[model samples]
Target: MRLIQINKTYGDKTVLKDVTLDFPIGKVTVLVGPSGSGKSTILRSLNFLVTPESGQYDFNDHQIDFSQSISNKEKLAVRRETGMVFQDYNLFPHKTVLGNIIEGPTQVLKMGKKQAIKVAKELLAKVGLADYGDVYPSELSGGQAQRVAIARALAMKPRYVLLDEPTSALDPELELSVLKVLLQLAHEKQSMVLVTHNMAFAKQIADKIIFVENGEIIYDGDPKKFFSQDNSSKRIKNFIASMTMENLK
Candidate 1:
């Protein structure tokens, strides 16, 4: 999937300025930047949750011109190809873990209920929640809930999984659990686009890294070189130092 010359704004504030990005298949692309740097906006745009006012979105056979009014069918079609996991987990409070995982497959994909449940159970096991299918969201811990959310996203069998601060809400111990699942996905070569503040996890899993600041990309290249500050600007160096310091605190 690719975004070309994308621009987005809210009133006088520009959020994304002519941003162009590519998400390659079977690779993990990590977006890292300071707060309010438009990383989340870029991630959301991947799933069509936040539409840019202008630019082109190319995914599979679909080429969307954001300058024109997009039809609901077009939006849904693009959305079905990507799964989004947000910081909040966003699980249905009234639904059990099994129900949440099967919701997309049974509703959107139109899979049979039995088949959906079967698939959901397998995904739950993949995320280390096989026994929690009958548990409700309210009963699970932060990490457990996030794992279920991951399973729910994977249940759709999306070509790419988009995650925005998936571990930001949890404590250090709980955060490790979510990161473990993500690392496993990386090893399995599941394509993912992630917006995160966790630099260590980013360095460990990213096949490519894009650094954004003030809604503009500062760096987009090799993670090893980017993290090593090789040929990087003073600004990039300072940002990394600051993030490292923050992590230490």
Candidate 2:
């Protein structure tokens, strides 16, 4: 996806300001920055969850303006190729793991019930939650819950996966488990945009690291140079310092 001078505002508060960037295809890219720096806003804008005030978004060769009036059907078609996972699992309390994964495909995609269940079972195993399909979300650990969430997103067969603070709500142990799954996914599939504070993981797996500050991208390139000690930008340095301390503590 390509974003050209994307801009967004809420009343007088500008959440994203002329942010321009290209997400390399078939690679895992990381967006790292301070909280409320518009990383999440960029993700939301990509999926049109939040419309931008100005600029163009190019997806699969189609360029669209956020200000243009788009039909719900058109938006839904775009959603089919993009999957989003949030910090919260957002699974239904009343549904079984199996139920949650199959609901969308069977209902929205109009897949047969048996076919959806067949697909769900395979995804469950792939995510390492093969035995948890019959269980409720309440019975699973945070990591397991998040895995199911990821699997549910995958069940839709999206081309691009967008993650927002995926491990923030988990404990250390659970967080590690979830992070491992994310790494596995990144290695297994080539397309994903991860918005996270995990610098270590970004350094390890990201093809490119994007640094956003105060609703704009200050830098976008190799992780090593972006986080280097010689980098004298106060905003970038402060963000790296704070994340390092948080991880250390």
Candidate 3:
């Protein structure tokens, strides 16, 4: 999957400036940067949650030209190809965990109730929530609820999962559980693009890391090389130093 020269602006602010990226299949790609650096914007653009003002996006045979008129056909295709997990778990309050997972499959995919439930059960198990399928989101801990959100996203069997701070809502101790689920998914060779500020999570799960700031990409490379002490970018160096200090505190 690739973003071909995307450019987006909001009023006087240019949030994304001529950015282009290629995401490897079956690999985890992490986008790390400071707040308001356009990291989340990049993820949203990738998922077509918000179309960029100009550029082209290509994934397999799927393509969208933001410079031209977008068709509902392309929107549906992209929705099928990409799944997004937001900072907040957007589960339905009235639905049980199982119901939340099955809603899209049964309604959107047109799968039968029995088959959808079966698949939802499997997904619940995959996210380590097999026993909680009957429970409500409000009954689960923050970490647990986030795991269910991941399960809901997976039920679509999307080609790429786009996560925007999947662990941000949890404390350090609770964060480990959510991070573990993500690592497990990464091991299963799920193609993912993540927007996060959790440097530790990025280092643990990323095959590739890109640093974005001021609406532009400053660095893109292997995790080791990008995080190496000898890496010469002062901006990224300062970011690492600040995050390290914050972690210690």
Clashes of 3: 0
Query: By TM-score, who's the top model here?
Result: 1
The better-scoring model by TM-score among 1 and 3 is 1
**Residue 147, model 3, lDDT:** 91
* Model 3 lDDT on a 0 to 1 scale: 0.90
Clashing pairs in 2: none
Q: What lDDT does each candidate get? A: 0.92, 0.87, 0.90
Per-residue lDDT over 175-195 for candidate 2, one digit per residue giving the tens place of the 0 to 100 score: 887888778888886488899
Model 1 misplaced stretches (Cα beyond 4 Å): 246-249
Q: Candidate 1 lDDT, tens digit per residue, 1-249?
A: 999999999899999999999889999999999899999999998888899999999999999999999999998998897999989999999999999999999899999999999999999999998899999999999999999999999999999999999999999999999999999999999999999988888989999999998889889888998888465488877788787785365
**Candidate 3 runs further than 4 Å off:** 246-249
lDDT leader: 1
After aligning candidate 2 to the native by TM-score, how far in Å is the CA of 46 from where it should be?
A: 1.1
The clash count for each model shown is 0, 0, 0
